[model samples]
Target: MEHLFGVMLVWLLAAVWIFLLVSWAITGDVSAVEAAFGSVVALLLAIASAQRAFPYVVPFSLATLGGGAVALPVLRAYLNRAAHAQMDAELIERACLAYEFDPKNYGALINLAEVCYKNGLLEQAVRHLEHAIQQAPVMAANEKRRLRMWQDELQHHPKLGYTPCMHCGARSSVGAVRCERCRHLLLPLLVHGRWVPRQLVHKAVAVWGIAVGASALSLLWREQLTGLNALVAILATLSVALGLIVWVVRR
Candidate 1:
């Protein structure tokens, strides 16, 4: 029975590792260090399997401890790399998508332009912003204000050069809210012209809440954990909740 229990425990650990591995593949959440840690864990598991399958000279407990120590670092590196890769991919996608603006929807154009600007595609952003401003009315105060804002923003950051709108041939400020020549009101529909999908934010919050709830439950009812572990769990739960609240407010 004791031997059976030990084997079951090893299988359970392997299952958890498998779940993490799948999650890493889906989300790219693990870094190079974490990948290395996972490899180490696999190595240790192999050693343990060998020892269990065939009688080994080394003590079982020592082997298990050594396996754990080697696996931890590998996991850390893998997680870091995965997370970085995911972020890079998202950024690249956002940059590419920012240039696909609808001409009639000046608000969306401005939003896309702003996203492009933030992503370091400043020239493209400026061009889009100029187009939006040109479509605005010349006498509209709001449009003029927006144009001025963009112009001032570009002035301070000269990499985003002034480009006269092809439609109106106006040398308008990016900061101008309206076209000086045509008086088009260039009102932005979204905040800073960036399209933040509410769905993504909601999903992030939901995941954060679930993780926090799990952590709280683990800390509250877990007798297996040491006092320090319990405290850490509680703190992590609180931190996750706090972070979620902050993100929601900011978004």
Candidate 2:
């Protein structure tokens, strides 16, 4: 056991030395190598002073430790860069697809526009957003307001070739519903004056809020009712009940 401890300590010291050597090679500074060597010596002294420190980690082999010390940084950097590139590509593709499928999907358009603007594709982003506004349902007053703002801004800004009406190929506001030339509707008109039954939305929201609040309250006090086990069970049951209420109201 003492021999094993001696060998393991030697291996650890070697690993620390290897790390310092790599750092010295990268930075090419005499002071950096000296600092790293001092840190490793301090670490070794601390380990030698602690009798129980080496025993727990005895089963790991020296070769395994050495290879791991070298491989870890290389593997980590490769994985990180690969993941970042994949995410960026996916986000851009999703943004493009969203605009193509539903030009009026304003949330997606906004996300795409933001990305484009950040990356210096401002004109393309504006074109996408303008097209989104034009296609969005005009019945929603908020949507109309959004479209009006973008249109008002675009008119003052550098004019790109007008986005032709999707239906009639005539130059018009991206928000234009009916084509002036063909008389065909390019997008659904928002029903601004149409009445929604206020009672239905109000009742649904009220019931949902009450059920959720009751579930949260029950979860907080469940410990007194039956202890940890019962608390977990009751919390699970109440959460399910709350979810059911949400689903029903949404439907």
Candidate 3:
């Protein structure tokens, strides 16, 4: 176990050094290596002091760490674009097939339309969304209206050739995955055809979680609840953190 940690530390430092070295090589910027100097040294010292690994140094300059702040965001944005550039064709086909199996379902139809729009089938997307709106029942009035608005926008605005938000009529750049006005995803794993703002649903859920958390804290303060009752409330409160972690990791 001790040897495993030592090897991991060695590989981690080597990886960081190589990354900075490569960044410098490609960008012809010394700051790429210099900016991480202090951090790398500190980590090495900490590991050596803990007797977990030997102290080592890379090609980084010994000067005070600075510069390269501007490069970070540019690098991150490039990576994000690269990540979303390719579509998983098989996944899309499966989604389309699933929607096909339930053509009469309004939510399914809207989902199909969203997929079609993403795949650049604008006419098909508009037609499916229009069908959803026409078939949507009274209970889905608000949702249907939202769909109607987007469908109408699509019909009138042929220049909206890019991906448009299902929730908002605003169109984003081609290959973009989110609406500029609404930061919610433009892709699937949607909730209820996502006619409702994801932000609203998140806020509602956060409020509910806060209420539950407060209840649990009050129970601890009062110390009056039974063991089972207290345990249940505490678990419910703790579950929020776990839920958020899962959502973030999966996303």
lDDT of 1 by residue, 1-251 (tens): 66655655565555555456556646655444444444455445544544463333123423443454455346446445444444543553343344233345566556656655655445556666667677665634665676577667767775624434434656556544344676543222112223334344434434443443444345343444567786787677677666766665666
* Model 2 / residue 211 / CA error / Å: 68
Model 2 CA deviation exceeding 4 Å by range: 1-85, 137-251
Give the candidates in order of TM-score, highest first: 3, 1, 2
Which of 1 and 3 is the better model by TM-score? 3
- Say which candidate scores most in TM-score: 3
| lDDT minimum window of 10 residues, candidate 1 | 185-194
Q: Per-model C-alpha lDDT, please?
A: 0.50, 0.49, 0.49
How many residue pairs clash in all the candidates, one count each? 56, 5, 0
- The whole-model C-alpha lDDT of candidate 2 against the native structure comes to 0.49
- Tell me each candidate's TM-score: 0.30, 0.26, 0.31
Off by over 4 Å in 1: 1-22, 25-41, 45-108, 138-146, 158-251
